[model samples]
Target: MNAFEIIGGKKLKGEIQPQGAKNEALQIISAVLLTDQKITISNIPDIKDVNKLIELLGDMGVTIERLNKDTYTFEAKNINLDFFQSDVFKTKGGGLRGSIMIVGPLLGRFGKAAIPKPGGDKIGRRRLDTHFIGFEKLGAKFIYDSKKEFFNVDATNLQGAYILLDEASVTGTANIVMAAVLAKGTTTIYNAACEPYLQQLCKMLNRMGAKISGVGSNLLTIEGVQKLGGTEHRMLPDMIEIGSFIGLAAMTESEITIKNVCYPELGVIPDVFKKLGIKFELKGDDIYIPSQKHYVIESFIDGSMLTISDAPWPGFTPDLLSIILVVATQARGNVLIHQKMFESRLFFVDKLIDMGAQIILCDPHRASVNGIDKKYKLRGISMTSPDIRAGVSLLIAALSAEGKSTIFNIEQIERGYQDIDTRLRALGAQIKRIEASAPTH
Candidate 1:
């Protein structure tokens, strides 16, 4: 219920580093359950969703030791399977979308796993069918307890088989890969998600003695091993946060350097931002965005409107479409944002439109933005954050606005970004966290 109070029109400067990848942290952390030995993971982000997943693991009897602020050692030697049936498990497990990943590792190691219908951003219908269907294809029995809203999977013996996924779902592919790693035979997964995070998972599993090939492609091959041993993994920098900072710098006309961005692993993120006419230079592993008074959007060679859409790996990420949309508000041209993965992700455009951005919400999946070229500054207005990406998008918009703005429900932003207010403050942003007042009865 906390909010962010920001005095806009201040330019941010200095260097900010992106935290460890949130999506990768969820999968890598869940992979600890696949083995009984100690697994060390470094560069873990200090965020709500990742912390919740770690706490859930600790509650399930994993011996977790914090080596430092961003490093942890986890041992799953004597897990208490009985805890899965406890009420505490239902409540905690159901609250996090990442909790669904535990099922594959648990089912692979313990032969059974159950989870309540997971919760996350209400962007659209995020179906669990991709996950359960993958498990079922691998010779696991799937059960849905409709009355209790629980999903249960049990496999006495898992034998690997060919799986052609309905969609290249990242979490689903990770879950199925985790399960397939310990199966009895070779498992081939076609149309798998080939994002860098997923590739990182595959490489880490290979390091842990799981035979996996096709590390950076949509097709993955895994040879099931009898057991996996301990291994160490370091997560990549969060690309979503990196993209956010790039957009933030452009919108606020600030010169900001994003350090240690893992530039090579960012896929098409930089190119996509470049299409929007945002300029930056890659100095080794860092990205430096110089202050810009105006940026223009690029159109097609045939003079058609520039359309940026989300696709699978090596394409534009859906997570940053919100940032792109927000950045497009001040650019010097028009662009169409197509949020193909999630229907409601573009709904936040209303708040930006209220702030004086010329945006037309074509539908739930697409938005057309007519950049005012900074001719009219956006006036600050109170707004509520709808999701993590949208929250940060709004915060960026507020940073470039003409007056003070209040953004309620900042918890959504905190779930993904680590110490965001502190980081922005370090860059000379006029923003502060305001705690909610206690209710009077």
Candidate 2:
């Protein structure tokens, strides 16, 4: 148990750089297992979840050499198949949702893969049905052990086939693509997730000799090859963090420049923040958000309350809804925040309400925030982080509030953001990390 003590009402200045995409890194790191040669990756975030996956890979005999803090070269030539049967494998594999993706490359190169049920943010029901169904479509036998809560997939002689996903699941699409890259025939995936992460995955696979088309579209075609060689990859900056910084700048009336954002890859994020009346200038690839005394929430064309919701790629991401909700707390008007992807994510509004923000939790999936409009500054209180996105949202709220605020369970925040307090501190934020006293059993 760790916590952050933050003194709010101080404007954050200077520049900050977004870390490499966490979701993309997870998928790309898993893809490293597909080849035995050295695959070098740069711009990797030094975060907990990524480190956990790296440790899991090392335990499985993948040769991991750290070229630097943010660069690593992995060689899976000497993977220990027997390690898959160990308790350490099951325990570590079940710790992060991203670990489920290893099944694809494992089944492709080693003929079988097994994992305990994967864990992640408990905001909603994140099912693995899409990943398994796609694997079964590509000639894999899927089995789940009821008693042990483990899943196994065996594809000794995989042959590609057509797969129309029930929904466009990002990890599901990435998993299936990795599996299909080394299969025996052509594969077609319809309604596949085409997020930039998936596009990067497709490009990296292609660079390694996998023939994949429709790199950034709903339909993907793959001509499976006998094998794939190693390649170098650099991950895109995390768009979700960029969105959070935009919201933070507006909330605190801070002039902050986010650097090297890879502007073209940020789809619908800037527009979504624009809807909240945030003003930012793009200088090449940098996003400069100037300080503002107040920002007004925009209404629909019909003068109705604006609604900020999430959709698949080409639409606003669900990950930033929490930041949007928190930023709206100080905006000039009312807006509806709909988190369509998750059912439990909006419950954190109670903490914000306790801190003097006017928010109505409409239901499990929606929240109505009546902007304080800077009429009065929010007063801080003690609260615990609920999830990754919500944790950062709370941190933003605490930074903008008037008094001192303490946020507990900060590990949830660190799982996503890399040294968030340290980074924010560099930009003039008053945040300190304090380790909690040991718990007495």
Candidate 3:
């Protein structure tokens, strides 16, 4: 394992660039399998999860070329269908939550797909029933193996039909749409997830000759096509990273400029941060956060305590709630952080409380934070990161704290944020990665 030893009390004051969206990259990378032609993708993040997915695609005989650090060309001309049934396939596809998406394209083109039980952050119970259920609705036969925790779907001929998803799951919607694009007829998906990632996916699919309407709404209509062609796609900036940077600038009292944010697509992220009284200016596509002595948390109109909560897209995202909770620790006044989607995500407040923040863990899903407003800096202490978002929150807290802090299990953070330590270092933050010796049994 590796750990980050951070020297706190550094106010970062430089320009940092947000990498390509990780969530979108997962969907787009998997979409490469939908076509046999060469597709070029720009702004792909070099993160652990994405690289794992890319490696899996290569193993399946996708011709992949690296044009640059952030660019790649993929052509799925000669896929090995027999490879999906191998033991190596189980190990490769079972470890990533994003691997579930491959099922859509494989079933669309090859008429069958199989995947082991997927793995990801243990923040909450992430169910795969939505993906399977959507596939079943699209004329695919779904089977599950309880002993092996594996799932298989077979459909020789897919016929489009109307699907009302139980919930607006992001990956689930993307998977179904990818499958529907090559079906026989029209497919209507109600209550779909309309995140920018989904929008970009729809746009790219249209460019490839798939007919899809309702690009930025819950109701999406798709007319199945015979085949899809290759097209180049440039991913938007990572919205979660941008939100984290905004909170980092506020907590550390630093003036930082985030370049090339692709502002219009951010959708309610900046406004949500503004409610926390973080002062920022939007100059062209860059977000500039100015250093301030104190930022006061704003309450509701009726004088009730301000509550920052997560919901579906166009609402606050659950991913950034941890950053919001950590930022609230140093703001003026109190606020309630509610994480509705995931039950265990808010449990990390215990570590923050130990670090000298006044936090009340109301339950498994909600916490109340009383901001110190810089009356006293947080005292750094040793901690372990439970998940990706929480790890970034702890890193931000440590950066604004008083002394040295060590965060173990940084791999959780690296899975999402590309080159995090190096990026923070570029902004004048004192964070170092130390390699630890392997333990012998």
Q: What TM-score would each prediction reach against the true structure?
A: 0.98, 0.98, 0.98
Report the C-alpha lDDT of model 3 over 1-441, residue by residue, as the tens digit: 899999999888999999999999999999999999999999999999999999999999999999999999999999998898889989988888889989999988888998999988999998887888888888999788999888878978899999999989999999999999999999999999999999999999999999999999999999999999999999999999999999999999999999999999988999988888999999999999999879999999999999989988888889999999999999999999989999999888888999999999999999999999999999998888899999999999999999998888899999999999999999999999997543332
lDDT of 3 at 118: 92
> Which is the leading candidate under lDDT?
1
Candidates 1 and 3 compared: the better one by lDDT is 1
Query: What C-alpha lDDT do the candidate models reach, one value each?
Result: 0.94, 0.92, 0.93
Off by over 4 Å in 1: 436-441
Per residue, candidate 2 scores C-alpha lDDT tens digits across 1-441 of: 689999999998999999999999999999999999899999999999999999999999999999998999999999998887899998998888789989999987877888889998989898889999999998899788989888877899989999999989999999999999999899999999999999999999999999999999999999999889999999999999999999999989999999999999998899888888899999999999999998899999999999989998978888999999999999999999999988998888999999999999979999999998999999988888989999999999999999999898888999999989999999999999987642332
lDDT of 2 at 410: 89
| Rank ordering of all candidates by lDDT, starting from the highest | 1, 3, 2
Worst 10 residues of 2 by lDDT: 432-441
Q: Compared with the true structure, what per-residue lDDT tens digits does model 1 show for residues 163-213? A: 999999999999999999999999999999999999999999999999999
